[model samples]
Target: MSNDLAAQHRPALFHRAWTVAVIACLTIVAAAAFAAMPGVLVDPLHTEYGWSRASIGAAASVNMTVYGLIAPFAAALMDRFGLRRIAMTALVTIVVGAGLTTVMTDVWQLTLYWGLLIGAGTGSLSMTFAATVANRWFVRRRGLVIGALTGSSAFGQLVFLPALAWIVDHQGWRPALVTLALTAGTMIVLIALLLRDHPADLGQRPYGATAFVERPKADQGAARRTLRVLYGSVRDRRFWLLAGTFAVCGATTNGIMWTHFVPAAQDAGMAMTAAASLVSMIGVFALVGTVLSGWLTDRFDPRPLLVGYYAGRALLLAALPALLGPDSGAVIVSWVVLFGLLDVATVPPTILLCRRVFGADGAIVFGWVNAVHQVGAGAMAVFGGFTRDMTGGYGPVWLLAAALCAVAAVAVYGLTPTAARTGDPAKA
Candidate 1:
């Protein structure tokens, strides 16, 4: 009887793991759909409306800011209201925002639709969502699962950028926006049909927990709990260091580079398609880098991993200005390949650091830190454009980003090294 029951349970376990993979894939597609928009839209909006780069950048700034700011609350809300409901709502919201964006003529409308609405929607589905699902569903190979999901987020850029750029270049920007709306609307149906908030909802325990171990109680008053996590985190020096370093991470990568790289490449006489392809290449390398970073995080101290990443980023950014022109060839490609490897690779180590320092509230604390990261990114998105207008080139901005990375490299070392070992699987 016992052997028969064990045989029967194996397939059920496989089903649960399969469900987690599907949810992770859905999250990846949603992330990619929204993330690919800003870069593809930048040049078209500039040419079509004669909008200043600064004005267009401001809308991106708004999008990035709202995306970051809402993350913690969104995480809390998911915990309270359930993941499937929140995820479905987020998809619908994105559909509305992207669909409406196709018709906007004014800058503020662009900001309202793309910046605020789409930003809010995507915020709910960010890395926090992946972490939540990984934590709740998987016990074994959790690190690998989280890394895979994070890579999917980076892969979203790779999957969407070329097609999006092609659409904007040949068809029109409106069609690109419409395509995004439809993609998101399709995801809404998938989420409603398949997503489950927890494994327990399907009569399974988390993958690794002992069957006899009681499930942990859900936090009552998730909103208040989220606020307390942020407040308590503020009092910790390690939290500040993590947030500060990650803020620079956001500034250099998502803020300045993702928003402006294509335009800057175009300024150097590259085709829009070529520039977008280069950005997508970065996505490819970022996927590899982030997943490897996750493996490193599980085995080594994350502090050193982060230090190495920031140093690599600083070197690459410093080289960017010289590598921009059409004649640069292999040198430019090498620079981009290296830059992509370091792009969002900062995330896994950053997540590790948050878990180390904040313990039980690590995920929520990471949300607040991520908000600061976006704050930095938003500031740089607007400032990079303004700097371009002032200097007539992106050279100065690249140098500034390199300088920030250097500063971050030094700043990360100041974090409490004691925190580095916390929750390390190797240590376990």
Candidate 2:
């Protein structure tokens, strides 16, 4: 196969990679929206069901844990079975979970539906999904595609948060849950109708490839292979570096900030709508930052980029305590803008690092790294609530996250650099 020969079969409207990227982005958007819903529901659940914050946080902790832990396996499954099949199944699972969440009367049901089922489902569509799509589809613009997809996750929060908050505030939490279910249901149909497993399925090479690159053969026993990777990864210092840094990334952003920020703001007497809008603002800045980080990953080394991002985040988090008062409008706005920029920007560079260090198995390796990230996140999600319950405020948690960010900044600097296989022309 020649480049020109592959070009001859290209679709008129867009590259199939772009089409797949769009579907992947949409899928992630739906999943991200569901992930953000718990934050908005925390107070409402307390109000309606008389659930304690710690109990709600515990359910979120379970969700976060399952969400992260399932990712590596999901990546392996996607490789062994098929992307479209896994994606479609994930969407259906999300629909079932979210639908059941609306009718749940007990906290354990919340844990089962939202924590186990929805968490696992959303895990399938996480950054690993973005990395898999980018790795399998495009050789030339993988970083940009990653950024776009990552940004789409942030954009999902931007689009859904305010409105969902409004619905939760005005109508009720049930309506908000129903909205997520419907969104997942719609994405399931879209994935089933439009998504293909791979470009090769349509008789085309990966975009930017001259010939079909032979992928590594999947291990005959995926479970054993995954366990082997986990065992091997534990001994590989580079994996620890990646996993440790990402654990902080998860702890600060998804675990502490996303899960607790709304309630933290509420504790300072901010309205739900106002707090949700602030989070939406963070989403807006995150979209820009993640996309820009993606572009930078293509052109520069990711190690320094991660160091800078972490350092900046530390500074922002360190300043958060003084910024969280009724009269701190200017400080709050600045925090939202700065924090959003740093929010998910860690993803692109982290993914780049995975590709550089892990080579052919980068996506799945990242899935394991992400699992650690979520574990850290889950720990903090529970801890943050418990801290608040014990201390009557989130001030200490913010400071703790800031300290973790500082550690991540120093830790990322220790990572040895490797050549990124960005857009390998042979890899289809």
Candidate 3:
């Protein structure tokens, strides 16, 4: 064939929007598997090693914090290297870190493997990946896409938690870790095959940006502007509001629940598999909530949405302490539905805030916000574990999580309208 004819006949990458959606879903599944993998091992580590709950929880705490700390830098790295390369690298790192966990014999090793390595890997798979999708793929339905991605993370937790619990019971924690590593490695190849940095890289425009004429290539404004965006957003009140709410979000969801839910369920006399299944149910609700949150973000004010979610979460946290025990199944299931529905629902709005506040710098700005979320989660995970150690239960932590959610609700509600300034009024 002639060269022109060959070029015309070549298959277009990202030819359909559904293809992008599928790739996004696959990334979320890979991400969710690793994220939930640690949770499954938490109880097993304690059972086998006779490790104190605090020690085990501390490892997870470190993981949550490191995961958060790495988010901003990870976003920057993705921006520099492109999402495809960074994601592929993260997938490999996660596999290695997870695979090594099977042989851990001490607390410090657990911390290093699960906390530093896996946490960093998960962070790379997090907001950086989310931003890549929102920034590059669909302009018209950015909110919906982000919602689905965030929902997938929650779905990972839901589907994998109980299943992993069964794996631990039948095959031991080693197999569970091995399964996670293999699954994550497979995802790396899929990502490399499917993902591109941006729509333009594939000779297409973002769904919404299509109406505008293309601008000529510019100099290194893209590089220089990252700093400007970072600096400007750091000074904004709305940024702090989003960050503060997210921090509280970390404190409540990951800081308290992901680190302790299985043990907490045990305290209430539920079996490990049963407890994990309950947590998985929460993931189901989160999937619905996050997707709805995304759809809502496109149609309404994100501030009100944030307010509602946080407030609802506060109520659930407060009720969590009173709801404990063997008879708590109904209560637990309700909490899962309510909490899950509101769980990742906060993310899309927060992303929206990032875009509105920082304009071209939304990706990196959101990265910083995600970092705050992680740090908040880390701080709480550490303290909550210590609290449980002192108190012999997670009751106090549950109450505290509720209070934090209340604070977050108020903080979100207090955000100035000017803070959410979408460039186009119609879009907002």
In terms of TM-score, which candidate is strongest? Answer: 2
| lDDT values for all models | 0.80, 0.86, 0.77
TM-score of each: 0.92, 0.94, 0.90
User: lDDT tens string, model 2, 353-410?
Assistant: 8888777668888999999999999999999989988999999899999999999999
| Model 3 bad stretches (over 4 Å) | 1-15, 212-229, 419-428
- For model 1, how does the per-residue alpha-carbon lDDT over 1-428 read when each residue is reduced to its tens digit? 99986765443436575576666666666656677778778778888898988998999999889988888888788788888888888888888898889889899999999999999988888877777776677656566666767777777756578888999888999998888788778788777778888877777777755462344566679889899888888988888998999999989977988888888998899888888888888888887888777777777788888899999999989988888976778888888788878887788777766766766576788888889998999999999899888888888889989999999999988987554233544321
Range of the 10 consecutive residues with the lowest summed lDDT in candidate 1: 419-428
TM-score of 3: 0.90
Per-prediction CA RMSD (Å): 3.2, 3.0, 5.2
Sort the candidates on lDDT, descending order: 2, 1, 3
In model 2, which range of ten residues has the least summed lDDT? 419-428
Residue 215 local lDDT, model 2: 55
lDDT at position 239, candidate 1: 88
Q: Under the 3 Å rule for N, CA and C atoms, how many clashes does model 1 have? A: 0
Clashing pairs in 2: 139-423
Output the number of the lDDT-best candidate.
Answer: 2
Candidate 3, residue 75: how far the Cα is off, in Å: 2.0
